[model samples]
Target: MTRSVYVTSIERGDGRQIVELGVMELLTRRVDRVGVFRPLVHDGPDRLFDLLRSRYRLTQDPATGYGMSYDEASTVQAEEGTDELVSRLVDRFHALARDYEAVLVLGTDYAGSQLPEELALNARLANEFGAAVLPVVGGRGQSAESVHTEARNAHRAYAQLGCEIPALFVNRVTPADREEVRDQLAAHLPVPCYVLPDEPALAAPTVAQIAQALQGTVLLGDDAGLARDALDFVFGGAMLPNLLKALTPGCVVITPGDRADLVVGALAAHSAGNPPIAGVLLTLGERPGKEILALADRLAPGTPVISVAGTSFPTATQLFTLEGRLSAATPRKVETALGLFEQCTATGELLDQISAPRSTRITPMMFQHQLLERARADRRHVVLPEGTEERVLHAAEVLLRRGVCDLSLLGPVDSIRKKAADLGIDLGRARLVDPTTSELRDDFAARYAELRAHKGVTLDLAHDVVADANYFGTLMVEQGLADGMVSGSVHSTAATIRPAFEIIKTATPKAGPGTAAGGEPAAAPIVSSVFFMCLADRVLVYGDCAVNPDPGARQLADIALQSAATAERFGVEPRIALLSYSTGTSGAGADVDKVREATELARARRPDLPIEGPIQYDAAVDPVVAATKLPGSAVAGRATVLIFPDLNTGNNTYKAVQRSAGAFAVGPVLQGLRKPVNDLSRGALVGDIVHTVAITAIQAQEPG
Candidate 1:
């Protein structure tokens, strides 16, 4: 039987989308094939469902997500009966549930719903689908006592209907009334209750939404600016100076387009980020002339300037009623909603109550989720040297918003801030440092000079080198100011990791009997790298792909050990396979001999670990091939960590798998370093940067 959770609300304005998104996040974290079903939806596009689909990379057909439209449901229930309506819905749900391990059943929204007994209808559908009911109650304008009674009644109502109630959520409660509501509900309800305080940002409308609602023309704004939440609306009826004083950080200034002075003044204030108004709304269908419009564009490059035909009074009333939605276009709001949900809800307890079974296969999405969860578990500070880069900044916003880790972005602080502001991103609590002018520059330069004195490096020369962002960022890791560093989005691998080698150096093994000929312990091999090849069914670790051009037998063994450790650390069970052109002594050559020797050496080092080598790629991965070529080998056909004989083979193989097989390769994650320092592809996307940063944070949590 497939496990499912039915997310419903008692009334309109319950803000149940937050609960829905949060539950979806939880489901995707545990299962690979998670389905989404909406029992009854409006005729138009479903914004919340679209958000879930895009964010989670869901593959469920959009047509299958809905049982029927609200209009259709109303007609069915009215003409035939409630039983006929539910029977059709249950059949539609089971059709979707059959293909998924778990399904998230989205219940009917009570807003404008014409079906009689909406609450009872949702309860009946949840019971029929065998899904645990998670009810949300609105508390935005209710008293604490009223909210308590409502939440209690919600739980009782579902329980009385024979629906298994997992928990109750009281959303959009005032901050002052959250604790009071929780206390009162805790004494009454059997299930756990979570209270989410009201977030004005979630309720605020974006300038684009307002423009669309009013059918206005967008005179000036980019997509990012249009997505800015209009947290407040200020009517611009006064002079420019007084209008500037009324501006708020995310408010939209409404005035007649003929008021050129107010338009330019408000935009100028926004450009200076004095309050950073969300946009300027021009009414009465009167746009400014070319000169004034040009001046406004120069003042605020991406600030929205919308022109509507309505007067200020009617437009203000319309704006007040327009609320922001959680949609694919509003990524910032999605992050905010998830952040708010994670803060208020005990995710672990709720998930336990829901008890969705974990998927046996580790999908790419699940691996990425595990990376974030592990990184967030023990927060570490990871530095990004390319702070001014747009992808890095975007990834920084996501990391900070998700509470993944503390970050220190190395660049000119003002440039980063201006760029972020232009892109409509908020780098909350992220530490920004300029390598050239930071107070620690002198200290870093002196230290670099001392460390490289034997190389004839002078203080001035060292000063210039230390002023580079990668060097400064690496030095911060060396000096314990940061836990790790992730660079190379724009820089070459050498430019990024060269600083790490020069300053942080490699780790040395503990003094033991197997010492070097000079009676000193040997340092570990120069840092190796691994690319987590996330195939459709599982994540495989490919080592030495981005480093180590060629290695002797001993270095090959070292890479194998390091790769296996990296795999196990990230939750992949390590079954080592030393790849060669041959399988298990079937062929002999310098290359195959090296792999065979390395396999023996690695097995000698750790006898308990599953190890196979001198194996053909086909034999190593395909069970049928393994049975024919090398039967009954533990690592054959099920290898999770693959060590190539040299970089030439490893790099080409990972690329082939990534491109030919359409795999999502996550690394080139540098291993064997004293601390974590990962590299990124020059063509990396925003999501790729986020995954790399999270991986770096997790690596930093490990002991040297």
Candidate 2:
């Protein structure tokens, strides 16, 4: 009878940090149970709020094994004639509300003419304690008329206790008034509206932290690596080319260049050899432009650069008035201050279920991602490109009109029915191609003479590049007709890796001179190609950006078994690290003996790999420098899958850690192809080509 949900938060200083970050982020989006009960003592004492609630243990409710009953009365001293302190807080929280199933009662700073008289004494204690009255408003200049008087006092005291559901928390807001308080309480709140997100994570900003937070000067404009720990909030005052046309790159924040032509045109369009600019904050003294320090020394040579000198709105108002003593942030600025540590360091289950907002999930609609919900539940297909076949035919007619996917499109059936009747699109029973017919020009001249049969094709040059309607778009993905294929707009990732290495290669084959994260692997069998890199729940896979340039250490043990079989085909357990410049048995070149021979030949070809390496990228991602230097190396300190050793150190260390590693580099995500094929970077970013066509439509049924 207790699936668990006992939450009792109504705040002032500690409504247990936004009820332990919205009941462990709504029990990681709907129930596996969640806990956290008492910790309220504000009129300045309950032994100093039970000594800061026993410094963070919060009495108890660690899901099911319940906790919290710190009484010490005066919740704003009887807010509206307190029925004996609201019947002793519903008799000590209804004796732990008859051992839980759902108890979310929140409302601490409860008053201001007693919020409809303390929501009618928290609705006779959620109806004499069965429990479910959510209201937690906790202030800081709230107003939408104090969130429409706490949603008309939790809808007239839960419709005089008949019951309704809608918990509201605006909590100290001001990231430009959170979508106007979610556009005036999203059609006036019924329940579920948590808004936390302005954390800056401090520590590395001195002059006694920029004279106690204001007026800048930490100059060292990193190509974009600028002291690599990424999350860019660069808001240089109005029309600095409207803050470089409000930048759109992973975790970008670069506006305070004091408008030296929009800070040297957003440091020559984002730095690091030119593409890196995650940190180069020159507000009023706007420095760094000897071509952004020679493109940050040809991108990331001595990266970490900071320089602040005020005037970018009093240095973003002394960084939101020292955003609560700056929680030491720097791992590319953890989402630049995850809204003040989502009420102080994400708690319990992982709180996220306010039903899809701004849409970005990648996984968890109850543990999904088996190649994206099994190529969207077995109905696969999705292609689109004839001028983005009307934006993948309106995302494949809304994923086959909501049954969710089985549509394709290449071109010329009368320019895709006059561009889907001039974009009023309807391809209802979809599936079309015409690459100027004749059985699609003999399947685009046998996939362009099987990718230029070693560069000498001529049946009139494979009928002039398979009749150039863009080589029937890589011959609708080498004639499977299309389970997956989302080409780089006008083509060139060497025209999408020469027809997937002459029509789909790698079923698992590679040897001698293969693994090229930088280069020198493969005495044989280390075939390379990677990109998995999800982002939402944090995935990571990376290897030879999209195919080798210099691979060795037994072709980096077949590019760490194709990046740990595409991070266990996306459920992710692959820890592999390999990146070098030394960690274990410290430095000694031949490029740290080719990342300690590709970490003992990828732990002797995947001997249950959680592989490590010559290491150091801060000891493979800093878990306190992998517990002070490789303590029991389970892949150094929790590496998700880094593996570079060549391809100019994996395409300039993933475009200089995708403009200085703050976070959000979804991919060059190609992986060892047989089915999914991707490559778009000439002007990539129609949201990285709609997440590279949703990672080539979740590799339409992967078996190839």
Best by lDDT: 1
lDDT of each: 0.88, 0.51
Candidate 2 per-residue lDDT over residues 393-509, each given as its tens digit? 444443443333455666666556544433333464777766556476865676677677787896667866765544555566667776666665556676765656565654554
Candidate RMSDs in Å, in order, are 2.8, 24.2
For model 1, where is the 10-residue window of minimal lDDT?
514-523
List runs of model 1 lying over 4 Å from the truth.
510-525
**Model 1, residue 25: displacement in angstroms?**
1.1
TM-score result, candidate 2: 0.30
* Candidate 1 C-alpha RMSD relative to the actual structure: 2.8
Write one digit per residue (lDDT tens) for candidate 1, span 1-704. Answer: 79999999888889899999999998998999899999988877899889889999887899999899899998999999999999999999999999999999888888787888999999999989999999999999989988888888888888999999879999999999999998888888888999999999889888889999999999999988898888888999899889988998788899998999999998887776676788889999999998998998887888889999999999988887888789999888888888788878888789899998988878888999888878888999999999999899989998888888999998988788777766667776899999999999999999999999999999999999999999999999999999999998899999998998899887665333333445443224558999999888888999989889999888888888878878988899999999999999789888889999988877766666789998988888899999999999999999989998898999899988988999998878998778888899887888889899999999889877
Q: How close is every model to the real structure, measured as TM-score?
A: 0.94, 0.30
Q: Whole-model lDDT for model 1 versus the true structure?
A: 0.88
